[model samples]
Target: MNTQPLDDAGGPTAGELGEHAVIEAIVAAAPSSSNGDDAAVLTHAAPNSQVVATTDMLVEGRHFRRDWSTPEEVGKKAIVQNFADIEAMGARAVAALLAVSVPAETPVSFFERLAAGIESRVAEYSAELVGGDVVSGDQLVISVTAIGSLGGNLPSLRLDRARVGQRVVAHGKIGWSAAGMALLERFGRENVPEDLTEVVAAHCAPYLTPGRGVVARATGATSMTDSSDGLVVDLTTIAARSGVSVDLFAEAIAPGPELVRAGEVLGVDPWQWVLTGGEDHTLVATTANDVPSGFREIGRVGKQSGDPAVTVDGAAPHYHGGWVSF
Candidate 1:
């Protein structure tokens, strides 16, 4: 493998540098044996820890757009989403392998910036960058597989553990990302209101706080999930899996000013976004005991009595659940 050659501006196009060069650059910061290897070797930090793995893919037009998302933003979003999956299981992210398929004309600088973003986010959790493959494709496709470690003493949070009489609590903002997407779709990036800047950024690059799942586990949470697929959808999954129903209190979930402003601009009910928005990836857990600090009680669990698995104040949600790839 060769290092990417720099242009006059110290940035090179992948077309100019070739495949081997770009691969070498991406693995430069990787902690594993990325160079000159068919596969990277991994060793558990603790003998008793169990490994948890998850994979996600992002396509150019389906998941993101170049005009709206920078290379760094794309990188961070990819890593965070996969990492959130690990955290949702009550584990600590330990390593990641990234694979990318891009057109030959893609710029080497794009990969460089993307690797930097991945490296920075991985470092935030003291995780390693492992090895992955590079391939040629018609358009950009990025896939990330994240590995996590669960301490032998801690129990993994699962969807089927939810039971009646448990409280449904969530930490972090909900519906912000969907609201941001609404803004971007209704009005172009240039026309987005200044008040909605935070939500817009949340959509482009939402922050994932590590260890919140562990906190839920410590607080005796019986069931947990990441709200990546919208609150109603994820909650419905838990409800169906556990044979329990979740009733969300609308009064408990007061819409923020940003969502309100977004609803006003879009001429739609803000509560719809709150219930059905996806990509927020916030931590939602059902606990029989008090919720841990930093999490608020949103609703309660009960025996399933009817067809609808998740409801808002005893009523079905007005809108459908979050993003669907197909």
Candidate 2:
């Protein structure tokens, strides 16, 4: 591994650094100490605890564009989306393995910054980077596998646990990421307004409050999921799985001032983002008891009864847009 510092031009390409050097540089930048190892040993879990795992993949042109986001931002986004899934299950992240495939021409500095970003975000939670593999490919692809612990005596939150008469609650920002994406598409990053910079930042790397699932679980949450797809899409999933219906209050989940201002600028309805935008990584859960401090009541559960699985103010939503892998 070359220990030489990168200059403004990003120093060397991955081909020049070689696979071993690239992996060494990445591990050096991150929190893992598993050098020259085929596998990493995970920490032991407490008795009666359950482990949850999830994997997500990001592609260069499809999921992210290098010109639109810095390598650090892409790295942070990768970690957040995967970890959010763990939290959605009412578990805390403990470890993660990152696998990266990049063209031989890709810059080594790109991965260094990316590893720094992963290390920074993982440091926020009690987790480690562990070990992974790197390979040369035609394009850049990042895959992360995250492992979490549902602490002793704690039950995992499930989509099927939601029932009729429970309150639908949410914590964390909704629609901000979509608004930021819109801003970037419309005005470009440099031309975006000073006040809306945060919105743009959200799209790059969404911020999720740590331990939200544990808090919701402690407060008697019935079911939980992260709004990775969209408010309506994820809630509809919960409704279908639980064999119930969700009635959302439009006012309760209305776009905030930033979204409203963004809508006016883009001539797009703010509700479009609020109801259909994805990647906010907001936590939405159902509770029969009190709503926790960090969460707000956005809707309620009801009988499915041949109606739409999810609705807004007792009517079908006008916008049915959300992310679809296909």
Candidate 3:
């Protein structure tokens, strides 16, 4: 059994210090007992139902900006958002592995805090780090692969099931992060509020957690997913996947005062923020009439035809949903 840290033995810290070198470093950090094995071996259980799995990545300067977020916050955000994905499938996150790529000149302090931040949420969610890799790269990028169990139930996959006459609902609030981003644009990192600013941070430093919204699941839901993309796109995904049309109410939007102020400052419509603004990672779901206890009955999912597609108040959306990569 050869036990060593990631930086040694020709890993990131001692390697040629390139992108591949960094990836090798982070990969080497995974604690594989097998000296020459490529993957890990986990304890298996007799097949009863099924295990749901998902993988996601967060890159600096693209997915996140270090100039706006602390390494610790970045670490937690990476873990929580992925966990949110697992929860959207109505599952419980159990463990995760992380791979980090940083410049060779990067201080060890950043790594220390980064690991601490990730570990804090992993522990908070009762997940273990298991193993990971560290390497040198052009910029800091964090890649995480999380594993979860379906709590003795079948995973509620995105493409699993869909039917007409389902109700569309979202847990938690909306437009907060969009409002937060507006604050950042206006305040220039100066006038950030104690509460509202976090939405921006949550967008950048998102804690798409699980425990906060679990109470709504056990009762019932037709289908569900995280609002990572925005209300329109996310609901569109549900409608498109479930093969149904979704209708929403614009005035039904319960805008918080923060978004109102954000709209005022940005000279935009707050209603637009609720429908289109994404990155909040709030829970959005469809139910067959019997909505969950904690979940709000927002709109109904049905056949989309004639006139407006995904109407709010029986009319088409005035604005498109959120931003995009391309």
* Local accuracy of candidate 1 as per-residue lDDT tens digits, 1-326: 11122111346666777888878778764445533578766773687888899999989877766656667777888888898889888888988998999787778777876787788888888887788888888888999999998886767999999999999999888999888888877765656788887887788777877788778888789888889999999999999999999999888776888788889888989998898899988889999999887789999999987768888898887776677888
- Would you list the clashing residue pairs of candidate 3? 22-135, 22-136, 25-134, 26-133, 26-134, 27-133, 30-132, 248-312
The local distance difference test score of model 3 is 0.65
- Model 1 lDDT at residue 251: 85
**Considering every candidate listed, which one attains the maximal TM-score?**
2
TM-score: which is higher, 1 or 2?
2
Q: Per-residue error at 88 for model 2, in Å?
A: 0.5
RMSD of 1: 4.6
1-326, model 3: which lDDT tens digit per residue?
12222222232242334444433433343223422345555546435645656777887666665555566777777787787787787777776777777767555555555667777787777766666666667877789887776655544646335467777777766877676666665654545666567566655556644553344456566578888778877777777766777788555565768777667767888878788887777887776756666567778877856444467776777776666886
Ranked by TM-score, the better of candidates 2 and 3 is: 2
Model 3: ten consecutive residues of lowest lDDT: 1-10
* C-alpha lDDT (0 to 100) for residue 155 of candidate 1: 74
TM-scores of the candidates are 0.92, 0.95, 0.80
User: Candidate 1 — which residues are off by over 4 angstroms?
Assistant: 1-11, 29-36
**Is 1 or 3 the stronger prediction by TM-score?**
1
